[model samples]
Target chain A: MLTVVKNQILVCILSVKYNIMREMLNKVTFLMNVTFMILNNASILIQWFVLFRLREDIGGYTMREVMLLWGLTAASFGLSRVLFARVYSLPELIVSGKLDSYLVQPKNVLLSVMTSSTNISAIGDLLYGLILLAVCGLGVRGFLLSLLFVVTGMIILTAFALFLGSLAFWFVRVEMLSGEMVMGLISFATYPDGIFQGISRFLLYFIMPVGMIVYHPVHILVRFDAGMFFTVLGYACLLSVAATVVFYRGLRRYASSSLMEARM
Target chain B: MRRQEKNAGANVGVLGKREKYIGRRYGLPGRKYGVIYRSVLMENLQYAANIALGFFGYFVFIFIFIKLWDYIYQTPGELIAGYSKEQMIWYVMMTEMMWFGSNAGSVGRQVKTDIRGGNIAYLMNKPYHYTLYILTKYTGEWSVRLPMYALLAVMIGTMMVGPVPGFKIVAVPVMAACIILGLTINAVFKICISLLSFWIEDASPFQWLYDKLLLVVGTIFPVEIFPQALQPFFKLTPIYTVCYGPAKLIVDFRPDKCVEILAAQVLYLAAGCGLMFFVYRKGVKKLYVNGG
Candidate 1:
């Protein structure tokens, strides 16, 4: 059993390496992708900058807290996109039956599918997030804590996306619907959590859980609490397991597309 | 003898057999544009779910802004940046509606697809002008989407803040004109950017940059909210024509201001058309020279 797990781990690593090598083959295109992504991330930050310039606080969040919010969101989003980009395209994969190769492979299908490719542009997002953190001037402890948030946030976001994409198993032409829901999720994530109230706030915390992804992390970083940290960690773990179960359950329904396909 | 007669008769037609056929149906100066426009409008209606979901996403933002502005107002009749709270929310709704109505992504993407997919080669040989063809098609799609979006915005706006005060019934026609012009300006700008793919191979980054600018300069908040130093620059850019100008006119209509805004829209429209032609002309040359 240990050897089986070891072999799966090795296969996942090699798959990631192969994807990286293929992307690096076009160094200029890869660089361009990263640069533009950085620019795009910065451009979004400008909206907050404009907002903060006008007023000192929004939903009781000062500029510094807002900046932290963006930093966490960008880092988490970037990490997921860079390392497990397939989560975004899972609907297309499922609907088109591109999962056949993963099913045939000896490795764990979910991990294999998740690590099959990387988005070079997301590297820009990751770098930009680090830059924002530095700009915010985090101490060693704070920076380490932010790193913890980045990993947990990525896990939650990837799991959330997996859950959403898994719905393709039962539905037809759900690609757009899933895409819009993800956009709606990101839309809420970028804003200061203080702005949302009542049902909207409740929806963010539960249904979308965008608050868990960025808002709660920003709050925890600003003023750390053991209970909140543990809750976040527990939620991430629970969500991850739920996502895996849902995906495999849906896997039973996937029919093949009969197209010549590759993992990358 | 039969082949010679066929070849000789084909020359009498304006361009080709297909051209003669399509031209007769859409040949008239006024009717040609209408036919292409209606076809695109119908095509957009076929993707009902996609359009519905898109509006739902837009609705989320509108919901947020209504809350944000409500919190900010604090008083019954407070004004921020020359707009009352109600006007401010209405302005956001109008802007969001116009933003969605642009439908410029598909316009630019179609251009890129045509160029990259090598469809441009055959499309260029068609009887109609490629630029006008794309513009009419997109205008139809925009027209189909706009009324539904506008109606939704009005319904939501009324529900959130009641009817807009000082909203003159007469201003609706003027607002509609501005909105149509905004859609045209947006489509033209995208077509210009997409034409760059004939040289750059990937124009998406430019589109992304342009979209970000539009988001910051006008869509997120009005240009009036920006620092005074940057207001003129924002107004001069195509962003004003696409979203800011139209929405502003709807919220705060003045006959004098209308004249100025309309003139600017006209100027931008002309400039956009000019840029579209210039880029397309150069791109076609590049295509021909490179055998694309």
Candidate 2:
């Protein structure tokens, strides 16, 4: 068990390094991409700024709290994309029969597949999140707590994307639906939770579960609660396991195309 | 010699010289583009189900904004930046419809891919202008999408906030014209940005920046909401012509305002076309391709 764990970790590290090196092959473009992404993320803040000018707060969130919400969401999303970018492409891979390559490897197929690519722009997102947190005057303890929430959020998001992408095994052309689902989660996660009520709020928590990804984490960050923290962590673990089960079950339905392809 | 003479006469006698000259001079290119437009329109209609899936994102945005605005407009007839709550909601509906319906993002991405993947080289030898070909194809897609989104917008807008408080039925035609112009301006500007791929390795970031600007400045809120000093600057940008102008006209129709917006849109559309052509011409000179 220890050896397997070690091997997976090593695989993850090496995969990330290789992906980063590949992107850095064109250093100028890579740097420009990261810088532009940071600006892109920052540009949306102008909306919040415009809104706050008219109202004291939006759905009980002051400008600072909203910034925190954006920070956590951006950082977590960025980390997930940077680390497991291929999760987003899983549907295409499954549909095209490209998973044949991963199946032949001895490593954990899912982990190998997930870490096989990187989004260079997500590095900007990670940096933007940290910068926002710093600007918000996050102390060391607050920073550490935010880090834990970021990880939990990242796990939930990646697992959710994996679960959606895994549906490709059973359904042809599921990519559009899955893409919308993931985008819906990200979109809702950015908004303050106070605005949502009744059925919409229920849907967010249960059906789509943006609540687990960001809202709960933001609430805990405001005032640390042990019960909520454990619940968030537990939910992350449960969702991860559920997604893994679904992926492997769907894997059984995957038919290889006998495609001859090389991965350099 | 008799058979050859007969065949030549048969080929030459179909049209008089004047009619043939007229057809060649005026009818051919327009007919060709019209055919391209119709074919693409039919292609999109065949996949209408796939296009309808976009409503999920549209609904999510409108729903969230409705909830947020409900919190903002505390009183029954309160106004923010000179817009009553109802007008604000309707304005948001109109802008969101145009934004989603325009299909600018996909068009921009297609242009970028074509340039970077060396596909444009193949297109250069074609008789039609590349820019016009892209515009016509996208216009076909827009025609199929915008009406569906508009219907949804009206339904959601009415259901969420009741009807617009003082809307004039007579204004609908003018509003439709503004909407079409706004979408055209948006599509043209996107093509201009995508043309930057000729020099830059990636034009996506510029596209993102432009989208964000349009979203925040015009799509979500009108220029009046900005500080008084900034409104003039904001109006100067294409965001006003592309997003805010039409939505504002729809939500509050003044004849003079409509005329001003229409005039501005025409100017911007012309400028956008000029810019697109300039970039394409320059970029074509730099383009190099190897390996068929």
Candidate 3:
């Protein structure tokens, strides 16, 4: 089991490196893609700044906390895209029978398929998040905690997307549905958690799980809580397991295309 | 005698073909575009489920903002940035509806793909104007989508924030005109940006930047909410005419503001069309088709 885990990690790292090298072949376009993405991410902050101008805090979040939320959300989202970019395209792969290559591989299919692609522009997001973190004056301890939360956030996001994308197994045209679902998760995660109340709050925390992905993590970062930290970690594990089981189960239903194609 | 008659009939057929190619070119140009528009409308209606699914994202955004504003306006009848709580919620609903309803990004993406994938080679040679063809095709889609989204927005807005205060029924037609103009300006600008693909390696980043600007400046909040120093700058951009103008008019209609917004929209629409044609002409001159 340990050997398998090690192998999966090695494959993931190599896949990411290969993908990055491929994109970096065009250095100028790659740099522009990343730079523009960072600018794209930063532009949205104008709204928050405009809002904060009118009021001191939104949903009990100061400007600093909001920045932290935006930073963490961007960073985690970027990390997920950078590491598991293929997860977003899983529905397309499933629909087109492109998973045949991964199915034949000896490595873990989910991990192998996910890490086979990279979003180079997401590096911008990762950098932008760290820049925001530095701007927030995060100490070493807070920064470390934020990094931990980023991992958990990445896991939850990936798992949720995988679980949604896996639905393509049973349903036709599930790609749009899954895309919207994943988009909803990211969209909600960026908003202040305190604004949500009652059933909506419950829905965010449990049904969609943006709470576990971002809100809880940011909350814990604002004031460290060991119990919440463990809960988030546990939730991440639970979700990862759920998503993996779903994907493999769905794999049983996958119909391979008769068309032969070269991977390289 | 039979051969001569047949020859004359063939001559008439050739003349008709020549007329079609060089003369009226499928009757009135508007009618030609109308056919394209109707076909696209039919296609979108056939796949209406996909567009309907987009409402889920729309709902999430509107719901979040509703709650956010509710939190902000803690007291009853409180006004922030010249809008009451109800007006603010309605403003969000309206702007978000316009944003989601217009399907603005589709045109840009379509243009980019056509240019990059060499599909524009086929499209540019067609009888219709390429930009006009795209605008009509997407407008047909918007015609189908916008009404449905508008219905959903009204339902959600009324349900969540109870109607906008002092919303005059008489003002709705003017507001509708503003919305149509705003969406047109938006689509035109999107085309202008996408036409950049003819010059640049990638125009998607520009599209993203444009979308984020619109979202942050006008869609999420009114220009009034921005700092006084920046309001003029915001107004100078199409974000003012594209999103804020129509939404604000709907939420809070003043006759003077209505006239100002309509005039500005017309000016922007003209300017947007001028820019679109300028880019398209320049880009087409630079376009290179690699293979057959």
- The model with the greatest TM-score is 2
Kindly list the per-residue Cα lDDT of model 2 for residues A120-209, writing each as its tens digit.
Answer: 999999999878877876789888888888888899999999999999999977888888889888889999999999999999988886
Candidate 1 C-alpha lDDT tens digits along B1-292: 9999898887765468778787687778768778878887888888765777677788888988887777677788876778888888888888888877566798999999998778888888977789998888888887777777888888888887888878888888988898888888888998999898888666777788888888777887888887899998888998888889888888888899788888999999998899899889888988852353
Candidate 1 Cα outliers beyond 4 Å, as residue runs: A262-264, B1-23, B29-33, B288-292
- Which of the predicted structures, 1 or 2, would earn the higher DockQ when compared with the native? 2
The CA lDDT at A20 in model 3 is 96
Model 1 residue A227 lDDT?
89
Residues A1-264, candidate 1: write the lDDT tens digits.
999988988887787778878888867667767788789878876777776665678889887887788788888888898888898899999988888888888678899889987887788888888778778877989998899999999999999999888989988767777787887887788778788888888999988979778888888888888888888898899999999999999998889989887654
For model 3 chain A, give the 10-residue run with minimal summed lDDT. Answer: A255-264
| Per-model TM-score versus the true fold | 0.91, 0.95, 0.94
RMSD of each: 4.0, 2.8, 2.9
Candidate 3: tens digits of C-alpha lDDT, residues A1-264: 998888889888988999999999978778988999999999888788777877788989998988888888899999999999999989999999888888778888888899988998899999898788778877998888888888888999999999999999999788988898888888888889888889999999999989998898888888888899999999999999999999999999999986576554
> Candidate 1: TM-score?
0.91
- DockQ of prediction 2: 0.71
Each candidate's interface RMSD (Å, one decimal) is 1.7, 0.8, 1.0
